[model samples]
Target: MTAVNSSDEIAPSRMLHRLTVLIVCLVWPLIWVGGLVTTYDAGMSVPDWPGTYGYNLFLYPYKTWLFGPFDLFIEHGHRLLGAVVGFVAIGIVIAAFWKENRRWVRWLCVALLLMVIAQGALGGVRVVLSDRTLAMVHGCFGPAFFAICVILAVVTGRRWRQDSDAERLRSSTSILTPTKKLAALAISLVVLSYVQLLLGAMMRHVQPTTSAGHFAGIVSTHILTAFFLWAMTGLVWLRLRRCGDLTLSRPGGILIFLVAVQIALGIGTWVVNYGWPSFMTWVPGSQSFLVQAKGFVDSMIVTGHVATGSLILAVSAMLCVRLFHRRWQAKQDRLVAT
Candidate 1:
């Protein structure tokens, strides 16, 4: 067997990395559009799967789609954006297989491709079945797909494969002594964030037919989980900062900032969607206030909250991957030295 240098085997391809970055950029907006669809209650606007009003997705009349009702506009636009992301995922898979040498990287791209296909299918099935529960599952799946895009971008970037700082850090076990604990915390945050997002999705997808008590229970749990997620993410950021690793600290800081913004947006979403809860309405004998449903401000705030939650999840996942990569590399270095 020919012995290939590990460094040579994993040589980074700038083009492939750029392609992955493009997919990430495209998928981020796809997630936002998906959120908007849920926010406006427009998931069933088209009333068909993989098509718009019996026309092929791409063949839908541009004029009607553009000048149609608000629900149709966002719903169709969401489909259009999803198609673009799907195409981009295909490109990533092809590029990875052709231009990238790392076996794991190639297979990860294939996994991404599969995930995109599954997500699209899930959306289509939700529409055809007219199932709100399926819609909630579809909503939860979008962020997971987006997180995979982030992972692909991070692993393929020059920073991941060739950064001198990363190399040095990987060689010095002493410097990474706290990384195990920090990485564990980061992973925990990622899991907690996903759970919170699932709860939020349940709240968003609750049908008008659902019981008031059921809705209230989901909302209460979601609100309480928000505070827990905020505190846990904050602690992770603080610990990462103390560790003094820029790679970890930078994303950690971004996660913390995003969590803060998400909390504000969460409040705004509640106010815009269901009026202020009685506890927060300050005026004497004043009822809670709600922005008009599907209004501009309401949609934007609710969609932004959903989008930011995905961003926080992506950042936490990235940080966890980087930390684990360094730890693995450091272990390998110690073995080689011994």
Candidate 2:
């Protein structure tokens, strides 16, 4: 790798990759705190837009927010983190346009910036109107933004460049055939995982008019989607492992693991929100299960569940891109050979 780096290759900007990584790191905690905001129902805690309690967000007195009610702390903190993310995103766009050589990747950075702005607008609008539906949209969109940041980070990394070289080398060797199934399966997982996350968000942000029957139907759908998503992740991993390509296989394994962890977290979240199901009343511990409202364990479990869903989305996206890169490289290698 050092040899490659020191060679005639046109290297990407180290500073830009670092900023890309910086934004990726920033978005995760933003998502976590955003999750915390929803878990604690703190979206309206501050009760003002573009500012907290009528004070500029950065100028909001630390004495008030830091030592204020838990909801205030989390909500104000979420805004603070969001502002930081926006700044970093702006920085990424500047760096990308100024230094990034690839035209499409530069456009990707622009898309990422637009997403950040739109996500911020969604959050502000959710607060100003106090709309649960928009809150749910805000919640669902955070993961999607996080997914984009994760992809951008991977694309800008040194490892990504190395992978391209590896792909070209593999294509030259002609040791492996192209995989239409992997590409199709990967894209399918990307879409399905996102849909599952959306359903999960709707379940969390139930409206007042949502009756027991409707909510139960949602629960049923969520559980069924989880099962199918789990199976798809497993199949993606199997396909990648069979190809013996670590770049794709590692993320494939990670994707399936995140899905498994997400399933367990979903169960934990259900237990926290609704207690053990009524059907389990005959079981030992089921009789004693009491759902805690806003308890410590409850918040972490629910927040973790949301964060894990974002991770599943990110890893699945990574797998899809790498598989495409491999296939494209294979095609190029065949053309060169002929």
C-alpha local distance difference test of each model: 0.82, 0.83
TM-score per candidate? 0.91, 0.93
Backbone clashes, each candidate? 0, 0
- TM-score of candidate 2 on Cα atoms, chains taken together: 0.93
Model 1 lDDT per residue over 1-338, tens place: 22224552266788888888998999888888888888788898889878788899999999999998988998999899989888888888888878888888899999999998999999999999999989999999989988988998998887776532334655544454446677778789889889989989888877778898998898888888888888887788788777666787788788878888999999888777767777777855438343564767778888999999999888888888887876666555555445
Best by lDDT: 2
Off by over 4 Å in 2: 1-9, 166-178
lDDT of each residue in 149-229, candidate 2, tens digit only:
888887788876765564356554423543898799999999998999888998989999999999899899999999999
Give each prediction's root-mean-square deviation over alpha carbons: 2.9, 3.6
Consecutive 10-residue window with the lowest summed lDDT within model 1 = 1-10
Most accurate candidate by TM-score: 2
Off by over 4 Å in 1: 1-9, 163-167, 170-174, 207-210, 283-291
